[model samples]
Target: MRIAAATAIAIAIGLAVSLSSVVHANEEKLDYDHQEKWQSALDRAQSPIDIVTAQTVRAEDNEPLGLQLWHTQAPIEKAEDNGHAVQVNTHATEAMIRGRHFTLAQFHFHAESEHTLDAKHYPLEGHFVFKAQDGRLAVIGVMYQVGDGNPAAQAVIDDLEAKDGKLPQPSIDIASLLPNQRDYYHYLGSLTTPPLTENVEWYVLPTPVTMSEKQMTTFLSHYPHNNRKIQPLNGRAVVHHQG
Candidate 1:
C-alpha cells in the first residue's frame, strides 16, 4: 500500500509538469510581444518594417509584377471577430499572384498601420492573404488614409458594425479593395504575428485606399489597436516595383 501511494503521487507531479509546459507553449504563440519565448519572432527577416521609399532600390529587371486577382459578386463564406481583428474567409478563386496560382484565404485589418512609410503611420491598413499550391504564403498590404468614404471597405465594416462574433453571407468586394496604382514595394520577410515564420513574401502598395473618418471610427470600436509593432530590417534589401 505504501509503494502504490508513492507511485501515484509521482505520476501526478509528472502530469502537472507536462500540462504547465503545454500551456507555456500556447502562451508564447498567442502573445505577440513575447519574442523572448519564440526565436523566429526575433529572427533577422522579421516583417512590418519601416519602409523608406528613398532608401529602397529599384528592381533592375524592370519586369512587371504579374499580379492577377479576380473576385465575383458571390457572398463570402463567413466574417468573424476572432478576438484579434475582423477576418473574412472566402472561397473565391479569382485571386492569384505572379501566375503561381494562389487562393484567397482570408483578409484582416490593422489600426494605425503595421508597415510605416519613412516612419509615417497611416490611419489603417488591410492585408489580403493568399496561399499558393505549394503552401507558400503571400500578403498584399494596402494602406488607408482618411479621405472620401470607401465603398469596398464599408461593405465589410457594415457587417461588423451591427454584430461582433460572426456574420453569415457578408458581401465583400475583393477586387475594389486595391488602389488604382500598381506600384509596390517588395521584400522577403516573416509574418507580423507569432510563430513569425520566415521566408514569407511581402508586397506593399504605395498608393493608399481611402476611408472616411466615420468608417475608421467603426473599425476602431472593435480593434482600436490591433497592429504588431514594426521589426528590424537586419540588412534585407527592399525591391521597389516601378511598373
Candidate 2:
C-alpha cells in the first residue's frame, strides 16, 4: 500500500512541475507577441511624410541659410544595426532659410545607393533632415562615389574616429555644404526606413560629390550593403533640373 502511495505521489509531483513549465513558457510568448504588435502599431499610425514647396528650400532673399551643428554634450542614441552602415542621431536643431527658421531633427546615411539615375548607383548617400516653421519638411541628399578628395566626407570620418561613436553636438552650416546651383531631381516618396512612411519629398542633388576609394571602403566596412530595395514610382512625377 505504501509503495503504491509513493508511486502516486511521484507522478503527481512530475505533472505539477510540467504544468508550471508550460505556464511559464506561455507567459513569455505572450510578452514577445505584445511587444511585436505594439511596435507595428506605432509604425503604421505615425506620419512619416512631409510637404516641400519652392519656399521650403528657398529662404527669404539676403538671408543666410539656417544650419547649425548639434554639438554633443553626451553620448547620442544610435539606431540598431538594421543593416544600416552609418551610425546617426535624430536630436533637435534649428536652421534659417531665406528669413524664416526651421528645425533640424536628425540625419542618417545610406549605402550602395537607393536613388538611381539612368540606372546608376552612387557609392554613398547622406540625408540631412529639417522641419520648417509652418511644419513643411525639407531633405537634402548628397550623392557620393569613388574619385577625388572630399572635405565634407573627411570631416564626418574624423568625427567617427575622434568621438568613437559618442557624437558631439554642434550646429552644421547647411548652406556651405550645399552645391552652388540649386538644381536637383525632385520626387515624392516615403521614408526609406521601416514604418516606411511614403510622405518624404525627395530632393536629389544634380551634381554628385567625389570620394576616394579609401573613404568609400571605410564606410562599406561597417555596413557592406545596407540599402532598401527601390520602391516603385507609383505614378508620381519626377522633376529633373538640368541647370
Q: Tell me each candidate's RMSD, in Å, in order.
A: 13.1, 19.8
Quote each prediction's TM-score.
Answer: 0.79, 0.58
Q: What range of 10 consecutive residues in model 1 has the weakest lDDT sum?
A: 16-25
The TM-score of predicted model 1 comes to 0.79
Q: In candidate 1, what are the lDDT values of residues 1-243, reduced to their tens digit?
A: 122232223222222222112112223214544545545533777779999999887765734344677664546755557666666666574554544677766777888799999999987888877666555566788998888987767878766555554653367777677787877887777666655666666789889988889888888787777677888888777877765
Q: Which stretches of candidate 2 lie above 4 Å from their native place?
A: 1-83, 87-101, 163-177
Candidate 2 per-residue C-alpha lDDT over 14-125 given as tens digits, one digit per residue, 9 for 90 to 100:
2222211211112221221123242221232122122223312332243333323333222334332323345444445455432345565555567766666655777777
lDDT of each: 0.68, 0.48
Error of 2 at 31 (Å): 23
RMSD of 2: 19.8
lDDT of 1 at 41: 30
